[model samples]
Target chain A: MPIIEVRNLSKTFVTKDATVQALKEINFEVEEGDIYGIIGMSGAGKSTLVRCLNYLEVPTQGTVIVEGHDLSKLSGAELRSLRSSIGMIFQGFNLLMQSKVIDNVMFPLLIHKVTKAEAKKKAEQLLDTVGLSDKAQAYPAQLSGGQRQRVAIARALAMDPKILLCDEATSALDPQTTQSILQLLKKINRETGITIVIITHQMSVVREICHNVAIVQSGEIVERGLVEDIFTHPQSRAAKQLVIEGKDPDEFAKEQEAKSKAVPILHESRKIRIVFGTQSSFEPVIANMILTVGVPVNILRASTMDVGGTARGDMILGLPADPASQEKIISYLKERGLAVEEVQ
Target chain B: MTANEINMILTGVWQTVYMTLVSTLFGYVLGLPWGIALTVTAKEGLHPNKVVYRILDIAANIMRSVPFLIMLILVMPLTMLIVGKTYGSTATVVPLVISAAPLIARMVESSLNEVDHGVIEAAQSVGATNFQIVTRVLIGEARVSLVSGATITIGTVLGYSAMAGTIGGGGLGDIAIRYGYYRYQADILWTTVILLVLLVQLFQAIGTLISVRMDKRHI
Candidate 1:
């Protein structure tokens, strides 16, 4: 069974001027132990949607089922108990700046009335888990952005939550810090087998470690699917755009060849598009083919990028000067499908 | 001035100190809870009861605007019922506290509001109960600012005690009005003013020192 089931959830926030629909009929299920990512631009309601899972925001419509209990129906003490099991982190790292790192990590446990010594021991262990064992005595302001986030992650996990809600948790960090934080999150998901709900605008974030992904825009979910399937065969406009930007060319040509038909694609009139993959390398093969045929070649646009440790490339080419030249280029790229775009 | 007159002035200074200190203590105690209630019932708070917030807000404002001397006279019946006199230090405390409560409460409420909303949200997200958030998160987060508010409230209440002269409360103002102003004793009048200034300086210094000591988080 899915660890979480959200059905047709919507929320409207009323301000002095007008009501804003923050969420609209969102439906999804987070399978147990899956690092589920909800990607969106700011104001896309991804944050609001994640908050609803822990009752941080009450949904105006729909229901949340977690571990066989409907969240909307829980209240007061029962609700508190429910929240204890679902940890949450925020964009700002939200550590109480006034508090020491250890105390901040110990807060949730202290609130549950754990003894001081015990809470301290647990906090220490959690700090070590996030790899900040020595900085427990320092205040949050004294730490670097990465260090602060590590403390926050430790605090969130202090309660041993089955699910962790990361609301743009890496958005405020530097690029290097963001990567480290992502690695830490991935590690937590792997070792502890915790489900993570990551909300972010960076496609690279979803590509990093998330197994399943959902894209939201303007308070509505636009697309969702398994990470590999969506990246390999995007069905949504936004997903396609994301995949294209992250693609690499030589690798892409090879992938296209894998998906190519038995009939040779060599034609004087047709343009060749190359898809890049992670392992695609600098090859003179395409140029060599044109040189061998004594035909002039034209290059349009090309891009190469690696995501999830695999290089992806996409390149568009104009017609070669002759039929044999095009045929030679097609066979050349197709022969290297292991490093180029497979046939699509 | 004669030794007798100087002694009377001494009595007046002591009276002012007595009234100021007692009223400030009462105001501080009363204001803490009222301030907490005001913040909790505010729009974005945990239990945002609009009606209760409005009523408390208006009552505090109306009570705040009333002059202390006038409030002393206004609450005469209630003061007399409680203290059995309308003209003594003990009787004066009732009206002084009544006047200072809302001012202190508002000061504390504003201080609490200065705390980062993120801190409170963080505490709540961790399954903290309302009481835990207030005492542990909200109050703890605003501790330094709250101390500064308390200091100001005490100083304002101390000022109010001097005006309790009209009610025959024997403070420095009572001495100045009854002896200096009535008899045209310029030296005594100047002396009382100097003494009050000194008192205010002392309170302000202590307050700033304590507030600074508690403020570990600059933001």
Candidate 2:
């Protein structure tokens, strides 16, 4: 069975002035040892969903079953016990600023009533695993952002949790630091067989480490599948935008608006997007298609990306007005094993 | 100053320090838990309870609203019951604590509130119980702020201990009233004023030093 199963979960936040629906019937499952990612734009309710997975923010409706226990049915003590088994790290790297690094890592073990000596030994080991054993005496404030996150990760792992929840855990760091943290998480998952659920807005994060992904859009799961599939063949508008944009979705939207205004006829013409996997990444398929079809295609946009360590290339081409030429171009691309779909 | 006058001044300093320190200690005994309750019941706090919070809120407000001199006289009977008298430095502690506790409570509440909510959330995510969150996470993280607030509380309590002089509560203020105001001794009055100012400055400097040393966020 999947280690974490979220079945039709919904959460509503009722304030004095207004009731906001933060999550809407979200459903997904993380198998044991899977590096699952939940990706979305800001305010897409991914954070709320991760919190509900651990029962930090109790679901307003439906149930969350983790390791065969329904979180909603558990008592307070039971829930806390379950939470101890589910490790969590946040974007802020919420280490106790007053505590030393070793103490911060030992926090959860101490909370669970482990003896000081044992907790210290375990915290040191975890810090070693994250490659910060030498800096154990330093305070979190004295460390760089990456080092702080490493301390947080060590603290989260102090309980030997089965599942690790990362809520935008690398968002606060620079790109290089984000990469290092992601690598550390990947290493921990590989060595320990710990199931990790990553919640992030950065597509690069999902592409780098996540095995399977769910795209959240406005309190709902718009699409979910293998990371490679979502990146190469995004089914929903949100997924396509996230995959194609790759960085700063809102900025891309604004750029798209500007492009439409600059070239109004570009949208009016028939456009088709073609995706090619690693096998065809080297071949000039688009060029070959134009030469065979004897028609010049207006290349709207083209980019290549590494999806799941394999090079995949995709491009949007404006087809000729003549239906015969369009059909020939589509078939030519299809014959070469390219996934083609008309862009609306 | 004569030997007798200097001796009187020394006693006055001892009385003032004793009343201030003792009152602050007693004040925290009542105020710390009260402040923790206030913070834990606040709207954004760990365990928010409207009823408990409202009661504590109103009580603190009422206690703080009453001026120290009026409260000193108003609680005179209660003071007699606790310390068996309503005069002298020891007796002044009762009213000094009574006045300082609620003010300390307010300060404690605000200091605890200044702790990052994200840290509290992190504690919760790690399965920390509410009590653990308060004592370990909230209290531990807000130590610097709490220490600084205590310094301010001690300073305020010292000032209030002086106000207790109006009711024959012993301290420098009593000497100032009796020797300077009543007997028109300018030299004695100026001496007491200078000592009080120095004591306040000493308290302020110590508090800053402790807070700065305790603060790991900056270093």
| TM-score of chain B taken alone, every candidate | 0.95, 0.98
- Mark the 10 consecutive residues where model 2 chain A has the least summed lDDT: A260-269
The interface RMSD values of the models, given in order, are 1.9, 0.6
RMSD of 2: 1.7
Residue-level lDDT of model 2, residues A2-51, one tens digit each, is 99999989999999999999999989999999999999888889999999
Top-DockQ candidate index? 2
Residue B111, model 2: Cα distance from true site in angstroms: 0.4
DockQ of each: 0.51, 0.87
Q: What lDDT does the true structure give each of the candidates?
A: 0.81, 0.91
Regions more than 4 Å wrong, model 2: A256-268, A282-284, A298-301
Fraction of native A-B contacts kept, per candidate: 0.51, 0.79
